[model samples]
Target: EGGVGYCGARRLKGGHLRGGTPAGAGLSYYYDPLPTNCVADWFCLEGNSRHLPPDPLQHPGARPDLNLAVFYHACNFNCLYCQNWSFRKATFSGGKVSAASLAQAAHERTACICFFGGDPTPELPHALATSRLVAAGVGRERRPVRICWETNGAMQEAWLKPLAASSLDTGGIIKFDLKAFSKEIHLALTGVCNSQTLKNFAALAARLEERPDLPFLMASTLMVPGYVDLEEIHGLARLIARLNPNIPYSLLAFYPQFYLRDLPVTSRDFAFKARQVALNAGVKRVHLGNVHLLT
Candidate 1:
C-alpha cells in the first residue's frame, strides 16, 4: 500500500484497537492534503482551532482566533455524517516535509497548533512524535504551545491513553466527538459500537482523579436521515448529562453531503429543533452546526 497505510478497524487482543487489514469493511485508509508536513498552513486562530476562513456569516465561533494547524490522516470511524469524507477516504497528499519543517511552519505563525485529521487520535505514536518535535522546536524560545486534537471517541482508551496523558501537560484541547448515545446508533453510523467510547469517556473521567486540570470538550453532530432522529437525540442528551454537563456538546445540523446527498438538507429549524431535543433531555449548552443559527 503506497499510501497512508491503515490496517483494520479491528480490536487487538492485548493491544490497542486499530484499523486492520484482516476482514470486513477492511480499514478505508487513504489520504488528502492538510494532514501532512508540507504545504500545511497555520492560521492564527485562538486556541488553534482548524476552522475554515470566514465566509459570509457562517463561522461557528467568532471569538477564538485560529492559530496553527497540522493536518493528519486516517480515521477509525466511518461516520455517515462525516463532512471530510473525501479527505478521509482519499489517499496521499501534495506536500512532503519533515517534522522539523512542520515545527518551523508553526513557529512562523502562532503558538497554538491544531492536530487536524480524519481523526488525529488513531496514529498516536506519530502524533506524539510530532508533538515532541514541535515542543522541542519552540522549547528554547519558551514559546507557548497548545496542542488540540479533534477526534471521534471510536478508538478505545488503549489507543487514546498515550495521547490523553500527554495532551494536558501541553495545554492541549481534547475535542472528543461522541457519535451517539446508543451503541446501535453508533454502529449504524460509524461502523463501531459506542461501548469502548463510553468506557474510554468514563476512563478519562477516572484519569482526572480530582480535576487533573485538563481542557476538554465533547462534540457531536445530529446526523440526518439514517443516522439520527428526535428520539436518538433525547437518548444522546441523557447520555451526556450523566457524564459532564459543563462540556459543550455541539448538536450540529445535518446537510446533504457525501452518501447523503439525496437526503433533505438540514434546515435551520430542524437544527434548532434537534438542539431543543437535546435540551429537553437535559443536555446543557447545545450548539448548532452546519446551520446559520448563530449571528
Candidate 2:
C-alpha cells in the first residue's frame, strides 16, 4: 500500500519520485517560457497586476509576457476523444524532475504557470509542491505567483481547496473541461461519471465572490460532433449559469482523434448554435475555441 497503486490511468507509487528524493515528483516532459498568442485571452482577466511579482524592481523578469507551460504525463479520465492521449505512454516511463527544478523554470517573466496534461488531477502533489515553491520563491512583497490549472476537475475533495487556494491566492484561474452533462453520454465519452467533476466545479465556483475582478473558475466543453450536442451544452451551461452566470465558458470545436477519429470535426453551424444556447441559458460570456477546426 505504501508503494505503487493504480489510480485511474496512473501508477501512483514511483510516479512521485524526482531527483532521487523520496518526495520528489516527476513526469513533467516539457517546459516553455515563451509567450503564445495561441494562449487564450481569458488569461488576460483584469486585476491580475494585483498579484504581480513581490518586487518588480528586483525581479526584472516579472513580466506577464511568458506562461510557463508544465506538461505532465498522467490523467484520471479515459476519454475516447483525448487530444493529448499520447501522454499515456509516458505514464510509467520515468522522468522524475524535482519540484524545485520545475519551480525554477517559472522564472520572473512567467505571467502564469499552467499545469495541464492528459489532465493534472493524477499528479497533483508535484504540481502543488511546485506551485508552493514558485510562490515562496517570489517572496513576500505581495501576493503569490499566478498558478493556473487546466484540469478534468476530478480531484478528490480533500485537494480542492489547496488547488483552488494556489490559484486564488495568486490570481490564477482553474479551467475545468466539462466533457458532457448527461450521465450516459459522459460515461460513454470519458469512462467516468460527471458527478465529481460537476461537484468540484460548483464547489470552486462558490468562491468566485472572493476575487470578483479576476474569474476564479472557468469551464469549457469539446464539441464532439455526434457525442456532445446542443442539448449537452445547454444542460452544462444552465448548471454553470445557475451557480455563477459570470463564469467564463468556452465552447471548443473538436477534431477527430484518438478513439473518436471516425467522427467528423465539429461543424461551424453546431458551434454557433451551441454558443447561442449557452448565452440563452444565462452564461454571461461565451467563447468559441478552435474555430479553424469547424468543418
Candidate 3:
C-alpha cells in the first residue's frame, strides 16, 4: 500500500498555448548564438536557427513515413502570428545546404520533406544545387520522395518555375501557404501584399492544367486576430475550386505566439466556422490545427 500510494491528482493546462519553445521574456523563441557568414553582404549569414525545437514529426521513427524537416532561416514575409519567427530571417545555416547529403540521409519511404521557415524561395539557387545532390541519390533508386515546400507564396516566377520543374519528374509535393487573401488583410497579417503570391498561384494553376500529372498542393493560412475573415477564406476557396476541386485547403488556428502575443488565440468556434466556410465555398479538404486533438 505504501509503495502503491497515489500522489495528488493533477492536470496540466494550456497545451494550445505551449507548443512553441519560449525564448527570453520578450523574444518568442529562443535564439541560439549563431555565427554570421562573412560573404553574404545583403543578409546576415546566421547559422540555422529555431524558435520551437526542430519539428519532431519529420524524423524517421517519429512517423513511419520517414519524413524530414529542412528549416531554412529568415523570411521575406513578417507574419505577425508566426510560430517559427526566429527562422523567418536570413541565416547562413538555414539557407544553403547539401541537398545531396540530405537525400543520402533519407530513406526511401520518406514522403514529406516538410520544407519550412526562413522563407525557402531565397534559397532556391542553393536549393537547386542541393536538390541536384539529393536527386542524384534518390532519383536513381526511384524513391517515393516529395518536397514539402512550405512558403508564404510571395516569391517571383523565376524561382517558382525552377521549383515547379524540379517537382515535375520527381513527383515532389509542393505545399504553399498563402497568408491571407485580400490585399489589405494580407498586408496586415504578413506585413506585405501577396499580389505576386496570387500571380504565382495562377501560374501554378496553369502549369497544373497543362501537366495533369504534376504533383502540387496550394494551401493558405490566416493568423488569428488581425486577419481571419470569411470573405477572404471564401475567396481563396472559390479561387482554388475554380482551379481544382480536389485541391486541399488547410485552415490553421492562429495562436498568440510571436509579435501578436497581445491578441487572443483564434477561438475554436472561429476555427470551426472558418473550416465550414471553406467547405461551403467549395474547398475539398480543409483541416484545422491548434485546438486539442479531436475525440
Candidate 4:
C-alpha cells in the first residue's frame, strides 16, 4: 500500500513520490474564505450547520463563521449541464496551489473547508493532502474545522474510505451528486457510466452506522426537466433507502445551463412529486434545494 496509489486516472509511483509532485498539487478555480450563506439548502437544516457556535464542543449545529470553499478545476464526469463547465478550462491552463498555503488560508475564523469543483474526483490527492495539513494545524482553542466534499462519487474504491474518514472525523458531510440511476440515462446525461458512482456510494453506505448522530453521507439529484423524471427518482431513492434510509437525500431544482440551456427550469409540481417519491421509498430525511428555480 505504501508503494502504490492513485490520483484520478494517473497512478503514482509512491516510492518515488516527492514534494511539489502532481500527487500533492491542487488546482483550484478560486477560494472563497468568506462566511457567506451556503447555497445548499439541506446544509442549513436544524442540527446541521444552521446555528453552530464558535466552540466546537458546544455545536448544536456545525456552521462556522468562515467557510473556505475550495473550487477545483478538473472533474471526472462530463455532464451535459455542468454549471461550472466554464471553469474547466483552468484544469490544464493555470490555477495551481500548494496544500500548505490552502490550509493556511483557513485562518482561526475559518471553520469549514469544502472541496468542490467541476467535481473533486480528479484532484482527490491534493484535497486529501490539504485536509491533513488543516487537521494537524487546528489548535485546541480554535473551533473544530469541518472538511466536506461535494463530488460526483466516481473516484476509485480505495479513495472512498479516506474521504469518508475525514468527514466522519470532522463532523462534515459528503454530498454525492447521484445524476441518474439507470445506466442508460446516466451515460446519456454525464457521458459516462454510473456504475462507479453507484458502487462507490454503496461502499460508503456500509460505513454509515459508524457515526449515527451526524449524517456521514448524503445524496442529491438535479431534477433535469425531461431527463431525470419520476422513474429516475424512484430508482435512485430506492437505492438510497436500501443502503441506508437515514441518509439525507436532496432533490435540486435544475436551471438550464451549459449545453442543456434549451430545457425549462424544473417545475414546482415535479419537485414536490420527486420529494414524495423519495419519502415513500423509505428515506426518512429528504430536502428540496433551489426551490426558487422551480417555475
Off by over 4 Å in 2: 1-22, 29-40, 46-64, 140-144
CA error at residue 247 for candidate 1, angstroms: 1.5
Ranking by TM-score: 2, 4, 1, 3
Candidate 1 wrong stretches, greater than 4 Å: 1-66, 88-98, 140-143, 207-214, 293-295
What does the lDDT read for residue 16 in candidate 4? 60
lDDT of 1 by residue, 126-232 (tens): 55666677777664334346676777665655766666655666655566676677777778877877787777766664444333333344556555755677777
Per-residue lDDT over 213-255 for candidate 3, one digit per residue giving the tens place of the 0 to 100 score? 4336557575365466777778888888787766656776666
- Using Cα atoms with residue i matched to residue i, what is each candidate's TM-score against the true structure? 0.70, 0.86, 0.69, 0.86
Instruction: Summing lDDT over every window of 10 consecutive residues in candidate 1, give the lowest-scoring window.
Output: 21-30
lDDT of 4 by residue, 1-295 (tens): 2332222323336546433333444355334434443434345322244354344554444334567788876677778999987865665453468777887888766767788887777777778888888999986755458888899999889998889988888877888999999999999999889999999999999999988877778998999988999999999999999999998899999998999999999999999999999999999999998888899
- Pairs clashing within candidate 4: none
Clashes of each: 21, 2, 11, 0
Clashing pairs in 2: 61-108, 61-109
State residue 278's C-alpha deviation in candidate 2, in Å. Answer: 0.4
Tell how far residue 173 is off in model 4, in angstroms.
Answer: 0.7
